[model samples]
Target: MIDFHCHLDLYPDALKLLPIVSARNLFTLVVTTSPKAWLATSNVFAGYENIKVALGLHPEIAEQKAGERLLLLSCIPKAKYIGEIGIDGSPKYKETISLQESILNDTLTECERAGGKILSIHSRNASSRVLDLVEKNCRKSTVVLHWFSGSLTEAQRAQDLGCWFSVGPAMLRGANGRSIVASLPINKILPETDGPFTTNRSAPLMPWEAIDIVNTLVPIWGIPKEDVILQIRNNLAALISEENFQQNHSDTK
Candidate 1:
């Protein structure tokens, strides 16, 4: 199973779970909330082939940790994944909206220059603005909207821009989830656990719980479970593979 966005480092027993994540060889993207957090935990899972640690600067704290923006730019070359980044227009974070936009612009610019990067972004209540920045700066990067909560119009716009969306169990159970899922092209949809945040039976989920996400999509798409699993896996491969191709093309020139 592939978890495109998960705060693996935020789990209470993160250290204890590392070995299990590795043993299972689960395809997981471990996103950090800050550059310092990424610096601290990234190397811990370096030996695990299936775990990829992304460098992120979450928007909720973007304005306060402005210094980390430079740190994030400098650290970009060291990792292929970039995320937990983007705008949050929720009421509590409205004050830093401008700062978040600036950070996102810079992040997308860097990703463009790098040829390609996989980003798991958070849009919250600012899907249109987030999509604007993405369209303005992104050239070759693969953008995945994490737990998207936007209208169908904006979603269609995103799809036209080649953006992908990641959904967790909670989203699948949300009021607009069904319409959003139905609106999206099946191939562009990805499963994410967003573990420690999404729950099943009142228990915080693990990265591997992403399997449940795939299972959830099965009936939603009216396809066989195995086909859904295969499609999702292929989608992950295609996402990274396309970027690898772009990076290689840039390198050759």
Candidate 2:
């Protein structure tokens, strides 16, 4: 199984968590949201070979001394993806939005030269501008929007921009989440736990919790649960492959 977005660093018992997952052959794409977690996660996964990591400045921690942020990001040698990065929509988040964009731009440039590194963007209330910057500045590899919350028009724009969409456990409990999953092309979709970040107010997810989320919408997509899970994993490969997603541009005509 492939969990495309999870925070492995947040687990209190990180060492214990892996044995259970490895015995079952579950793999994860871990996203580190801060300089602290970024360092810890990279070391924890070092030599494991089964984990992939994304290092970036998340909106909540986006405002930082520029030198500090860049240095920490560059230190993660295992990092091939950039983000859980992008604008957030709260009054407090507004102050750091510019910092987020600045950090994101420089990271994208570095990723571009580093041979098309992938990204996992998080766009909350700023999907329109997220789409704008992605369309213009993404000379890097594929950019995936994890747990996307936007309109169909925005969704279409995202698809047009070569950004892949991911859905989470929230899809199981509500109309809005289910509707978003129903709207996406199965080929471009990926499944994630957003693990420690996507909890039930009680327990955060382990890797396998992703299974229950996939099972919930099995009938809607008209495929078997096992097949759907397989496709979601397959979609992860496709989305992360980078060769498949080509950035589209409109010329000044």
Candidate 3:
């Protein structure tokens, strides 16, 4: 199974869970909330090719870590995946919206300069602004909006800009989320667990549990579960190939 966005390092028993995840052969993109976290997590999963660590500075804490911009930029050239990054406009974080935008802009700019990256973004209540920056700065990069909570129009706009969406069980449990997923193009959808933060019956969701998302999509897409699984696999393969092709083309240029 593929978990396009998960916080593997944030799990309380991360080390213990490593073997279980490895045994399941779950392809996971572990997105860190800070550059420091990314460095440590990347080292921890160095030899595990199935587990990729993305360098990120989450918008919710953008103000506090504004000084880490240079560190983020320095880490960009080495990071193939960039994410858990974007603007959050929820009431609690609304005050730092401008700062978050600035950080996101610089991050995207640096990623573009580094010849593009596969980004897992967080858009909370700022999807429009986040999409705006992505549209303005992205060229060779591939973007996936994680746990997206936006209107149909905004979702369509993002689709038009070539952005993919990552849906999780936590999101699927909600009526609004189901509505959003039903409206999106099936080929552009990817599954995520967003675990340690998102719970299932009060227990932290595991990366392997991302497969549960297939069952949820089954009813929404009016397709069989096996077909849903195959579609997700195909989507992941296509995304990976697209990123690889972009990287290769960039290298040639």
For every model shown, what is its TM-score relative to the native structure? 0.92, 0.85, 0.93
Off by over 4 Å in 3: 242-253
Give the alpha carbon lDDT tens digit for every residue of 188-237 in model 1. 87778788877888888877777676666777789998888777766776
Decreasing TM-score order of the candidates: 3, 1, 2
Worst 10 residues of 1 by lDDT: 244-253
Please give, for residues 29-50, the per-residue lDDT of candidate 2 as tens digits.
Answer: 7887875667777777776545
Runs of candidate 1 exceeding 4 Å displacement: 242-253
Q: Quantify all predictions' global Cα lDDT against the true fold.
A: 0.83, 0.70, 0.87
- Candidate 2, lDDT over the whole model: 0.70
Task: Supply the global lDDT for candidate 3.
Answer: 0.87
- Could you tell me the lDDT of residue 120 within candidate 2? 83
User: Best-fitting candidate, measured by lDDT?
Assistant: 3
* Candidate 2 lDDT for residue 210: 66
Clashing pairs in 2: none
